[model samples]
Each structure stands twice: as structure tokens, then as C-alpha cells.
Target chain A: MFVTLWRMITFGFQNFFRNIWLSLITVLIVVLNLFLMSLVSGLNVVGQQTLTAVRQKVDLSVYFIPTTSEQRVDQIRQELLRKPEVQSIRLITRAEHLQELKKSAVDKGLVDAAIDALGDNPLGAGLVITSKTLDGYGAIANTLKDPKYQSIIEDTGNNFQTNQTVISRLSLIVNRVQVATLWLTLLFAVIAILMVFNTIRVAIYSQREEIGIMKLVGASDAFVRGPFVITSLLYGLVASILVTAVLVPILSLTNPFFAQFFAGYDINVLGYVREHLWTILGLEVAVGCGLSVISSLFAIGRYLRV
Target chain B: MVTFEHVTKTYQRRNVGLEDVSVNIEAGEFVSIVGQSGSGKTTFAKLIIAEEKADKGHITIGGWNITHIKHHEIPTLRRQIGVVFQDFKLLPKKTLFENVAFALEVAGERATRIKSVVPQVLKIVGLEQKMDRYPDQVSGGEQQRVVIARALVHRPKLLVADEPTGNLDSINAQEIIALLKKINEFGTTVVLVTHNREIVNMLHKRVITLDHGHVIADQQAGKYLL
Candidate 1:
């Protein structure tokens, strides 16, 4: 049994190198499949991060009357913090709001004019409220509308209807992108499978005479079939290694661009890829080897009758 | 040590490959089957190796009836009988040594046994010096010798040569015939199928002549009579 296995392994290498061009073409296809799978996963991570960042920026602010005391604003801040839906609430004093406006005006070269016109701080104190989810925003807005706080409140940004519309539209776009990526991934996967199948079939067809000779020499089915199957598995294995070698460097180079794209979102695409490198490569190897083996089995079944 | 008892075979389209053919050869006999094209010569060779099943009757090699041999058992039957074809079906990429050793490898022989037996068989066919050459690197006669060497690796009880010299020139054909004769002298049954009248006449051995899927004559010391 050991002798037979060694012979099969050696013959498999002989077959692989003997048809070098065809083997390379098969490996190339497997590489493309694995690369596309990784690309889809990367896009998914980036897309989720971008949507979360956009949603995080969509918070409501509760403005207080200028005469409201600092104590009252602090009480409102503490009450909002206790709510489960509220992620955070920051108290923006009138003076702090003026300072923020002045910094932005400086960027536009209108700082001096804006400060002269508003001698005293006309901006009201406010609370900036963030919720854990987009759906929670509506509940938080309703809670602020209670009569107890109406007297001191100058304006409550309770545009729930408009906010809901914007969130739904964003959700629609993100969902569509995910769906399209899935379909594209599936389509390419099918094409890659067919190409591998045909490549293996041609490889086996070229060895028809050799197969006949083996049968005449009294080779059993497993002995004759072993070399071709092993050759295909090698194609998958080598392709996976090639893809990882190429992908790691490419992903590293693109990390800065991805980080810039999701600047304030705290999304670390490179970190994600690094953490899941083995899992990603493992999935690719499984897929690559799986396709090659199945293709080889079918091709051998059709061509190697002996 | 081979027997065909009332065997019949018909191919698709109702073409007759063999018709109620029955023959027997004792141990260590050299027999030649001669016929015209489409006269069941190739079919008879195919049947002996179980490449084609007989439509009727039975074939037994050394008391083993193989009329209804299962698919998995075909390999075992072939290992016992060495078969050679006119085309010399050697793997083009494999060297002469690898080609010969392939027979033993397929039968799961140990590496030591393969290393020992393959060289011995190649030496018998006078190809020991050319063992490193690929099939395409050798002449037509040398390729056929490698095929024969491969056939002898198993030390089979019977060797069947189907038009083994069909692709060779006159001198090469004579050499192959001489080699087959030498192999037969070593107590192995040799069944040579051919249409070459000169070689057949020179053998002066038992000859079975077939015409249209039926045996016309079986003669001791036959003279290639049509």
C-alpha cells in the first residue's frame, strides 16, 4: 500500500509538471475565485462601518432658553443619561457653543465679524443626544416632548418623520449594495467552477492513451484514478498559497485609503483582515480544493473508463 | 492452460465478433491465431483479456471460469494474462523503466520487488541499456520491446500478443518474433495473433485460422493456409 501511494504521488507530480500550461491556467482561475470572495468580504465590512458612522452623526439637540439656569440643564443631562436608548448626552453651555461657532467661522475668515455682531452670547445652552440605534431616536425625541420640560425649552429638534425618511433611504441603499455584491459573488463563483471543470476535462482527455495502457497493465480503478485526483488537489493548494501571498501585500497597501474613507467611523478594515486572515484563507482553501477535486472526479469519470 | 467452450460474441448493430468458438491449449504451448481483417482475430484477443464480454458460452483460464466476470475482477484476470497491442501503448512521458515498473506498481508490489523484477524483465527483452529513454525517444521496435517488458513484469501464466509486430519493418518484425519465441521456451503459454504469412509459416507450430468469426482450420505444424 505504501509503494502504491508513493507511486501515485510521484505520478501526480509528473502529470502536473508535464502539462505545466494547463495546470497554471487552472490555478489562475482558482486564484480569481478566492480573491473575489475576499473582496466581497472586505466590501461588506467597509459598508457596515460607513452606515454606522452616518447614523451616529444623526443625533437630536435640545436647546434651552437663555434664562434657564445651569442647574436645570445639568438635571436634563443626567435624566437623559439614565435612559437605555440614549448612548450619550453632552451639555453645551452658551459660552461653549459660541467658542465652537467662532472656530468654524475662523475657517471661513468670518470670525471677527461674527464676534462683533453677537456681543453677548445669543446662542442658547443645549444638550446633544445620541441613541444606541436609529429606531431609538424616536423614543428619545418623544420623551423630550413631555410637558415638564416645555417651559424652559427653546427648541427641541423633534423632526422624527424627516429623520426616519433619511434613515430608511440610507438603509435601502446599503441593503441594495449588499444584495448586488452577493449576486456578483455567486455569478463569478459559477463561472470559475465551469472553467475549472473544463480545464480538468481537457487534462484527462490528453492522457487517454496513457490511461488505456495502464488498464492493459492490470491497474485497478483507484490506481489509475489516484494520480489525476492528486494533481487537481495540488492545483488548489498552490493557488491558495499564491492568492494569500498576493492579497496580504495588496491589502496592506490599501489600508490607509480604507481608513481615510471611514475617517470618523472607527472602522479598521486592515485590522479586521489581519485578525481573520486564517479564517479567510481557510475558507478559500476549502472552496478552491473542493472545486478542483469535484471537477477532477467528474472529468475522470467521463474520460478514464478503465 | 486456456479454454474457450462454445463461446459467442456479437457487437452492436448485430455484428458478429465470435461465433460458437471453442479451443483449448495445454500448458506451455505456443499457438498462433491467423486471420484476415474483420475475421474475429482482434475480438478473440479482446475476449481473452475480458475487454469485451462474450455474448454466449464460457472462457476459462487455468480452471477459472470468466464468462460472467464482475467489473472489479477484471483487473485480477488481466494481471494473470500479459497482453500487448500493435500500437505499443507506452506512456509517452514515462521512461522505459518507469513504463515497465508501472505494471508492478499497479498491482501494489513492494518497491524492492519492483526494483528487482522490472530490470530483470527489461533485460529479457534486450532493453536494459535503454531503460532511461522515453517512448518518443526510442525507435518503433524499441517501444514495442518496452511494451513486452511491461507485459513480462507480472511473470504471467499466459502472454497474448495481438498483431505485436504490425508496426515494425521486416527485420524488426523478425526480431520481435524471435523474442516472443524465446519467452515461450521459458514455460509460459504464448498466444500470437497475426496475419503475416511468412512469420506464421516459419513458426511450424499449432495454428488456428479464422474466417468471418468462425474457425476454419486448426492444424499442428500449420503452413499459413488461407
Candidate 2:
């Protein structure tokens, strides 16, 4: 058994090196397939991060009547905190609102005119509420419309509606991209499988006479089929190594571009790839070896009838 | 020993490969099967090695009925009976040494055993000096010699040669026949399938003549009478 296994391994290497061009082509196809798979995964991570950043920027401000008590405002803040959708909330006093308006005024003359014209702080106190998700904003808006707080609330800011539109549009784009990437990846997977199958078929076809001779000389099915199967596995192993070697440097070089594009969103593509290197390589090995083995099995089956 | 009890083999279009043929050869005998093209000589060799199934009867080699040999058992059967073909089916990418060692290698022989046996067989075929040469580098007769060496590596109890000299000239053909005769003298049963009357007449051994998939004559000390 050891002798048989050794012969299989040596013969497999012999076959692989003997057909160098074919092996290269097979490995190239596997690399392309793996690279596309990693690209899709990377895109998904970035998309999720961008969506989270957009969701964080969306908030609803509830303005209260100036006569509303601080205790009532504190109650509303506590109630919002109890809800899972509300990520955070902060109180804005009437004085703070006026100070913000005054700071935003381009000229001191306009600010003074506004303060003198009003004769007092006309701004109302409010609570600024940030939600965990895009849908959470709508949930908070519904909660604010309750009759118990109707008299105390003056108006809800328009930021929620504008941000909702942005969130919905981003969701549509992301969903479409996900679907398209999935289909493209699947299509490339099919092509890669067929290419492996055909390459193996041609390799076996060239060795058909040798296969017959082996059987005639008392070679078992395993003996005749082992070399081809081993050769295919080598192709997968080498291709995985090549893909990793190529991907790491390429990702590193492109890191700055991706980092700059997602500057404030904090989507670190390079970091994600670095953290998941093993997982990515593992996936590539599984796919590369799996496809080659299946293809070799099918190709070798036809000539083993002898 | 080999036995064929009313063996019949037919093909997809109802073409007869062998038709109700029955023959037997005892141990340590040199037997020749001669026929024209499509006369079932090759099919007879195939059946002995369990390459084709007997359609209507039984075949036994050394008392083992291989009429319906299992797929996996074919290898074991083949190892016990070395087979040689006319085309000299040598792997082109392998050297003569690798070609001869391949038979034993497939049988799971250790490298030490292969090293010892391959050189001995190549020496018998007078190609030990040229063992490192690839098949394409050798002459036709040398290639056939390599095939014979490969077949001999197993030291099989029976050797089946199906027109092994068909592609060679008269001189090379005689050399191959002489080699087969030498192997038979060593007590291995030899079954030579051919249409070459000169070699068969020269053998002066038992000959089975076939015509249209049926045996026409079976004679000890037979010449190619057909």
C-alpha cells in the first residue's frame, strides 16, 4: 500500500510537471474564481459599513413647548432610552438653542437685532434622538405622536424624512449590488467548473492509451485513477497559494484608495482582509480542490472502462 | 492451465466475437491460435484476461472460472497472466526502464523488488543496455522488446501474446518468436495469437485455427493449415 501510494504521488507530480502549460491554465482559472469571490465578500463588508454610517447620521429632534417642565422632558428621555431602537438621546434647553442660533449668525448685528426684536429667548427646548437603524427612526416618530406628549411637543424636525429618503435609496443600491455580485460570482463559478472539467478531459484523453495499457498490465482502477486525481489536487493547492500571494500585495496597494473613499465611514477593507486571510485562503482551497477533484473524477471515469 | 467451455461472445450489432468455442490447454504448454482478421483471436486473448465477458459459456484460468469476473478482480486475474499486444502499448513519456517497472509498480511491488525484477526482464529481452531510452528513441523491434520485458516483469504463470510481431519485419519477428520460445522453455504456459504462418509453422507446437469465429482445426504439431 505504501508503494502504491508513493507511486501515485510521484506519478501525479510527473504528470503535473509534464503538462506545464495545461497546469498553468488550470491554476489561472482557479485564481480568477477565487479573486472574484473575495471581491464580492469585500464589497459586502464595505456596503454594510456604509449603511451603518448613514443610519448613525439620521436623527429626530422633538421640540417641546417652552412651558413644558424639565421633569416631563426627563421622563420622555428615559422612555426613549427604554426602547431598543433608540441608540441615544440628549436634552437641548431653550437657552442652549438660542446660543446655537446666535453662534450660527454670520454677523453680530443680525444676532443682536434678532435678540432685541424677540426681547427674550424664543427658541424651544427639545430632545435630539438617534436610532440604531433606519426603521428605528420611523418607530420613534410613531412613539412621539402619542396623545400623552401631544400638548408638550411643538414640532418634529424634517431631518427624519430627508434621511429616510437617503437610507431607502442606499438600501436599494446595496440590494441590487448584492444580487448582481451573487449572480456574477455564480456564473464565474460555473465557467470555472466547466474549464476544469474540459482541461482534465483533455489530459485524460491524451493518456487514454496509457490507461488501457495500465489495465492490460493488471493495474487496478484505483491505481489507474489515482495519479490524475492527485494531479488535480496539486493544481488546486498551487492555485490557492498563487491567489493568496497575488491578493495580499494587491489589497495592500489599494488600501489607501478604499480608505480614502470611505474616509469618514470607517470601512477598513485592508483590515478586514488581513483579519480574514486564513478564512479567505481556506475558502479558496476548499473551492479550488473541490472543483478539480470532481472534474478529474468525471474525466477519469470514462477511460477506466478498460 | 486454461479452459473455455462453449464460450460465446457477441458485440453490440450481434457480431460474433467468439461463437460457442471450447478449448483447453494444460500447464507448461506452448499453444498458438491462428486466424485471419476478425477471426476472434484477439477476443480470445481478451477473454482470458477478463477484458470481455463470455456471453454464453465459461472460461477458467488455473481452475478459477473467470466467465463473470468482478470488475475489481480483473486486475488480480491480469497479474497472473501477462498480456502483450501488437501495437506495443508503451507509455511514450516513460523510459524503457520505467515502462518495464510499471507493471510491477501497478501490482504494488516494493521499489527494491521492482529494481531487481526489471533489470532481469530487460536482460532476457536483450535491452538492458538501452533501458534508459524512451520508446520514441528506440526502433520498432526494441519497442516491442520493451513491451515483452514489461509483460515478463510479473513472472506470470501464463503469457498471452496477441500478434506481438505484427508490426515488425521478418527478421525482428523471428527474434520475438525466439524470445517467446525461450520464455515457454522456462515452464510458463504460452498462448500466441497470430496469423503469421511462418512463425506458427516454425513453432511445431499445438495450433488452434479459427474461421469466422469458429474453430476449424485443433492439431498437435500443427502448421498454419488455414
Regions more than 4 Å wrong, model 1: A36-45, A48-158, A252-272
Instruction: Give the per-residue lDDT digits (tens) of candidate 2, residues B57-169.
Output: 98999999998889999999998897888999998878899999998888888899889889988998999999998899999999999988888888888999999999999
How many clashing pairs in candidate 2? Answer: 0
lDDT of 1 by residue, A53-76 (tens): 777787877788888887889998
**Which residue pairs show collisions in model 1?**
none
Candidate 2: pairs in clash = none
For every model shown, the clashing-pair count is 0, 0
**CA deviation > 4 Å runs, candidate 2:** A61-74, A87-133, A157-173
lDDT of 2 by residue, A174-253 (tens): 56766776677677667767776776677678789888888888899999899988988998889888888888899899
Candidate 2 displacement at residue A249 in angstroms:
2.3
